[model samples]
Structures are given as structure tokens and as C-alpha cells.
Target: MTEFKELYVRKGSVAQDYIDIAQDIYVEINNYFKIIDCNLKFCRMMNKPRTELFGTSILDAIHEKDKIKFQNIIRNALLKKFKDGIIRSDLVDYKSRIIATTMKLNPILDDNNNIVGMFVKFSSFRLRVEDSAVNTIFMSIYNSLTDLYTIYGTDTKIRINHVNTSLLNILGYTRDEMMGRHVADFLVKNKDQEENIKKLFKSLESTGNFTGEVLYQAKNGEEIPIHLSISSLVHNGKVIGSLGIGRDMREQKRLESENKSFELKLQNQSKLAEFGMMLQGVAHNMSTPLTGIKSSAQLQHSRLIKFKDKLAEKYGEDREISDNITDIMKFFELIDQSVSKLSKIIKNMMSKSRDQQSLSKEALNLAYVMNQEIEFLYANQFFKNRVEKNISIQPDLPVIYGLYSDFSQSFVNIIKNGVDAMWDSPVKKMDIVMYYESGAIFVKIKDTGKGIPHDIADKIFDPFFTTKPKFKDAKGEEPNGTGLGLDSVRSLLKPYRAKITFESGPGKGTEFIIAIPVKENQTDLNN
Candidate 1:
């Protein structure tokens, strides 16, 4: 009989032991509670000295404020014969810190099935003191005190949660008047800003965060500019809402505008100074040729009259004297040639000067322009012998839209540099190639002479920078140039949107590439 009872009872104990172990491990165990009755596992979990806790009320450990709720739970459990119930409240732990508790209750029954009492189990749900203090510091620092702060819920409704003293002062409104209002109510002055705010919230739903400047309206119909930085508030790896901090930028915007105006005035003054210098150089350059032409004409006039008088005396007949007069005209003819040459130079100078101020938009044949500049450069005696020139233009290259004089000057400057580079070279050959790519015309001038030094390549295009020997006057004394040729070239090409680049190394050749945008509907030579 004893062995049969042991085997039957052992099967019932397995299920009871499983429940007892789960209650101790899976539930909170540091909370305040009183045990009315417990299983063997609960007895071990609480370290109780008694064998059973039946017939004991579990309300003995209840705090004064929660004793009424605890007693009500017990009475309800007895009336309903509840197998399990719960009471949620706060209690002080052994360390005297307030801890939140959720108590689990299990009612006991007598042999007649009448309610006897209840067993109580509880867990502590409060955060650690250090963790709570750190959270409070973070909240105080991140929260703005000088602006109206808002957080957007996941449903996209803006909730006004914080209003600082400065924001209330600016808008002439009390904190109560501003808090709890929608963000749109303050955005009345800027419809675009309101729409953008809506778009920002919608985007945040997909992309987590956004920040930008916005304009808000005050209660008195005034605009307030703000620099807003917004980020998503996340919890448990999920974005719950968005937080925004606003900084006023009205004074900042005014300062930026003032600075911009000052800079524009300074740039205009600089350009005017450059223009005055260019005019002075041009006047000085033109005076030499004009003086020479004047002297030559005066000398030729005297020689012509003397020759006419001598011829009239030798040839007695009137018709013969007329013929001799025509012969004397040849001397004047030479003077005309000098004057014509001077006129052409003056005309070219005038064209260059006018082109500096007014850029003309016309379709120009780049190859023809290159050839003209080369012909002009070759006409000079020094360049004629010093540089060997080869020009190859692709037949299918199209015309570019640019000012004629400006484009010609750009090519002339490069050709002049090429000639100057070859003065010391034994084999002075320059290869120029023109081609078209995409919508741009490219002219590459490559020279077979000592190239620019690698260190000064970038400085070559700078104003007044030169590698050429100092200019010498007619008596071999060094003369100074205006040192504005490359500067003028750079300034002229700015309006045309032209690009220039070069590749050079010592002993290896120098290559310069000029690319200009081609015009639509322009014809190519090959076509």
C-alpha cells in the first residue's frame, strides 16, 4: 500500500513542481509581498522557515496608501474564487528607494472548497537611481528653453510640448497661450514653410530625420526666421516621433545681406581700377606709331616738292613736266604704305579695346580665326625664323559662338608664347590641332621646346608672371612691359566660358588646350 501511494503521488508532484519553479523565476521577486500559502518551490524561493503559510492574510506588508486596494483585491478574489489575480502599486525597498511592483495573487481553498486565503508574489519594475539621474540630465540639456519646442507624433500631428521664456517674450504671448497649439497655427505667415513642414514630417516617416530653416509668424502678424534642427525620437529600435530645436536667425540674415552688398561694391571698384590701367597702357602703345607716322609724312612732303621743282626745270615741255610730277608721286606712295600699316594697327587696337567691355555673340569659324592669328604672329621677323608651325583642323569641327576679337586674342597669346619658348631651342616646331567633341571646339597648341618647369606651371597663368627674359629697348637697355597680356586674356575669356589647360615638363614639350562651346545650327567646314 505504501509503494502504490508513492508512485501515484510522484506523478502529481512533477506538474506542481514545474508551476512552482516558473512562478519564482519568470516573475518579479524583489517586491513587497506576504505569503498566505505556497508550494515547496515557493517555500525555497522566499527562504521561509515555516512549512506552510495557509490561513494567513497577505495584506500585512501593504503600505498605508495601498492597503485599501490590497484588501479589496483579497475580498474580490475570495468572492469570485479566483485562481490568480494581480495588484499593481509602488513600495519602498530595503534600500529605502521607491520601487514599482506588480503582485501576483493565488487563492487557497480548504477541504470543503471554501476560500481560506491567498499567496502573493511580486517583482520590482523601477529603474536604477543612477540611470534615472542620467536621463534627467539628458532631458534638461536637450530641451530648448528659449523657443517654442514641439514634437510630432507618429500620426503626423504636431503637439506643442515646451515653450521657453524668450519665445514667449518675442511673440508677446504667455506659455499657456502657446503650448498645446499645432505647429501650423504659428506658420500662418509662410504658407510655403507650412507645406514644407508637412513634407518634412512625411519624409521623416520614411527617412528618420530632417533639419532646415523655417519662417514662423508671431501673434502680431510679424515674421520670425528660425534655424530648426530636427531629429527622430526612437525607442526599442523604432522611430516614435520627431524633436525640433529652433534658433532665431533674423539678425544673422541681415548681417549676411550687408556683407554681400559690401563685397559687390569692392568687386566693382577693383574692376574699375583694372580698366583705368588698361586704358593707360593702350594710350602709351598707340602714341609710338602715331608719332612715327606724323614724322614720316612731314619728311616725305618736303622731298616731294623739291623733286617736283627739279623735274620741272629739266623737262621743259608742259606734258613732260606733268609726267615728271607723276614720278615724284611714287615717293608719296611709299608714305601711303606706312600710313596704311599704321591705320591697320590702330584699328586692331581699337577692336581689342572695345571687345574688352562689350562681348559680341556670333558664330565664328575657330579654324579661320586660328589661321589669322598664326599669320599675324609669323609676320614678325623674330617669330618667323624662331618657330616652325604646323596647324591641323579637323574637317568636321563646327563653328563656336564667341566674340571674334576675344577669341583671336586668346589664340594670339598662345602663339606668341610658343614663339618665345622656341628662341633657345635647336628644333623649334609647334603643332596645333583643332577638333570638336560634344558641343565644344578644342584647340591644342603643342610645342617641341623646353617646357615650363613643373613647379611653376600653375603660376604661369597668373597676372604679371613670366618666364621670358626682360624686354630690351632699341639701345639694348631692359624695358618693362605692362605685364597684363595673360591677365587680359583670362579676363576676356571669362564671358565666353572658355577653358584653358596645359601640360609641360622639363626637356619634354609644352601643350596648351583651349576649349570653347560650339553653337547649335552652325555649319562645319567638311559639311
Candidate 2:
């Protein structure tokens, strides 16, 4: 009947499907254990075609040690003694290579319910049960975690075997596109960074790991900066591969750059505030000479008017007229001296506050720079009245090539720092010596005050680091230390290829020495 035939067809299909389960290699064999039909995997395992595998005794492929066990399992299945008979066994391929495998057997029955053949499934042994479980857990974490960029199984030749989703997503590449590529292919495209890349690999091989910043290029043509840590993956006392873990450093690098920019702005603002305080003192100091000039002029005018009348009354007396003439000349001399002092003060302020854009590389006379800075320092009442300055200048000091403003600011900051260091000391003295030695300009600024503590001496040049109290100027306007003075000095000196060093001890004194190299072709302008 049609219903009976359809049922038989469905049953036959189900029986065929049973052999495909839980195995890569499956076959149908007669009760005599000769292969009648086999899947592609079975042919591949035997290293032969299906035509050659057909009618071949299955025992021929079974390893000698496993052959008896495999035959026993098949016989048990044929007898219907065990339904899911399975055995751990080994097989020998056509090339005589042994492969560990797990085998499963099931009986095939005929229409009369007699055992006709058997179905056998062989699964290749790749991982032990414990290793398989661990690998599964590792894969779950590797793919699930999204923040960390990971690369695994990078072999000794630097070929990339596996990359996590995080790295693939960041690099804009699929797993297939990145697999089997050299690790350096994704890194160090920039020619300037090639040397550093070589060093990184060298360190990795020598030390078993490397931790540093590296550049990675993405598929979208974007360059990514990464802080990568790569450690060797050792197996059986040999390094077989490497594991790389990385973090995206672009955001952090951006923040650091922005922070430096912000610090520079703060430094400029601090300088402006200090300049404003200096201007106030200079104005106050100028007022005295201005008052003297005004008062002397008025007195001279009144005295000359009265003398003019007396001149007519005593016209015949030459002695009185000559004496009056002499007194008028004395007043003129006093006014001239006041005008000259104001002029010098104005010139010093102008030189100190020159426009930054105008500060370009040129031959700078050290003596002139020191004189201008020293004169400007006097504008601060504390430096003028409180601290005693001992200045030594060598005649014809060699000229160094740099921006005038840079040199001026560096000089002033050092002197100002020395002055501030002596704020609490009873013997407040600052010694500044500038001389030429070894084809370089040497400037030594020393202060006899509270010296830098040994613990903090090394950190003095760091931005926003300070221990000084707020400085109250002539107008009583207190501006707190911006902590960028010495830091600014350090930055300014870098362009000139200069070096700054200091010697200090608690309660003894602090001395800072700056050495600026001179260009060989240039000579001292003063010479």
C-alpha cells in the first residue's frame, strides 16, 4: 500500500540521519565489518576516495591496539546488546599515521529484524575534555568583553591567528581579513616609528614581554595610538606564541595635549598678572621723580620771577646776577637728572614686556639681558628694598643665539625665584654671576634663604608645583604663585639647547646654574 511504502521511506531516511550525529566521519558497514558506504569525512580520514573506501575492511584503518575493541563494540551493536556502544580508539590512515578518535556504533536491522549491518561514527580527537572546557570558557570571555583589545596565538613568526571582536571592531576589519597576517602589518606604518617598532620587538623577544605605546592603522585609514602589552605564551617550556592586550590611547593623548595647552595659557595669564604688578610699582616709583621735577620747576619759576625784578634793581651788581644765574643752572641740572632716570625706567619696562611675536632667533648679548632684567627687578619694591643683590658680570660676555624674550624671561624668573626664596630669611641676599666659559654662557643665580628640601628638589621644575606663599606687591594686591615660573624657564631654555641645574639643601641656600651654548660662527657683539 502507499502508506506502508511512505513509512518505510521515512524510517530509512531517519536511520541514515543517525550516522551523521556527533561525528565528522561516519560509515555503513556489513556484519562482516567491511565498509559498504561512507561519508566524505570517512574517506578523508582514510586518505582515499569513496571508491577505494567501499568494500574495504574497516579493521584495516583501525590501529592495531584499538582494532579488537572496535570489533567488539561493532559486534555488540549487531547483537543489539548495547544501543549506544562507544569506544575511545585510534585509527591509522593510508599514510600510516595514527589519529586518536572516539567511535560510536549502532545496529542496522533487515525487514525480518535480523542484523544486516552497522553504522559507525568517528569523531577526531582534538582536545581533551578538560582542555575543551577551558577553551570554551576562554572563548566566551574573549568574545564577550568589549573594552579590552586582545590578540591570541600570535606565533613565533608574528603571524596573527586570532583577534577578539574588540580589536576587529576598533580596526574596522573582519576576522577573516586579519587572520594569518603578520602582526607588524597592522602596526608601525610611519617611517619615523620603524626604529621604535624594532626596539619593541627586540625587547619582547629578549624579555618575554613588552609594554609601551604603539601605533596601529585601521582599515578606514585612521591611525590609532595604543598602549599595548604583549606577553609570550609558553607551552611545554617553550615559547610558542604571544598574547597581546591593548588599550586605546587616543582619548588619553588628546586629554594630555589639551592639558598642556591649558597649562601654557595659565602660564601666560600668570605672567600678565605679574607684569601688571610690576607696572604698578614702576608707576609708583616714577611718581617720586615726577613730583620732584614738578616741584623744582615751580620753585625755579617763582625764584626766577623774583630774581628778574631784583635783576633790574641791582643791574650794576654783576656778582648777584652771576650767583642767580648759577642757581638757575643747578635747578636745570636737577630736572635733567629726574628726566633721565624716568627715561631709563621706561626703557627697561619696554624691553622686558616686548611682544612675543617679535621674539625671534638672533644674537643676544648676555650682559644687556642681565642689565635689563636687573633694572626690571628693581620695579618690584620687595626686590629693591628687601633683598640685597650681588651681581657679577664678565665684560664682553659671548653672545648666544635665541629669542630675546626667552632669555629675558628666564633671567627674571630665576632672579624672582631667588628673591622669593629669601622671603623669610634674615640674611636675604641674591647673587647673580654671568660669564663665558667653554664656549657657553654661564649664569649662576644663588639665594641665601630657605633652601629647597631634598625630597622636593627634583620636583621644582614640574608645572603647578610650588611651596611659596602669596606675594603681596606695592599696591597690597596679593597674587598667588602660579607655580609655572621654573617650569616656564625650563620650557623656554629647551629651544636654545640650554641646560639648567640646581644645588640646594634645607636652611643652607639654593643656587641654580644655566648654561647656554653659543653658536660657533657668532662672536660677542660687545667685542
| Model number with the top TM-score | 2
Candidate 2 per-residue lDDT, tens place, 287-381, comes to 78776786777677677767766876778657777677767867766776767777667655655565333435677687888887787678789
CA lDDT scores, all candidates in order: 0.62, 0.75
Best by lDDT: 2
- Where model 2 places Cα greater than 4 Å from the true spot, the runs are 1-258, 261-333, 355-357, 469-479, 520-527
- The predictions' CA RMSDs to the true structure, in order, are 18.1, 17.8
- Candidate 1 regions with alpha-carbon error over 4 angstroms: 1-32, 35-90, 93-339, 359-388, 391-399, 403-428, 435-440, 449-506, 514-527
In model 1, what are the clashing residue pairs, if there are any? Answer: 28-123, 36-53
Worst 10 residues of 1 by lDDT: 23-32
Look at candidate 1 and tell me the lDDT of residue 189.
Answer: 46
Error of 1 at 231 (Å): 23
Error of 1 at 105 (Å): 9.5
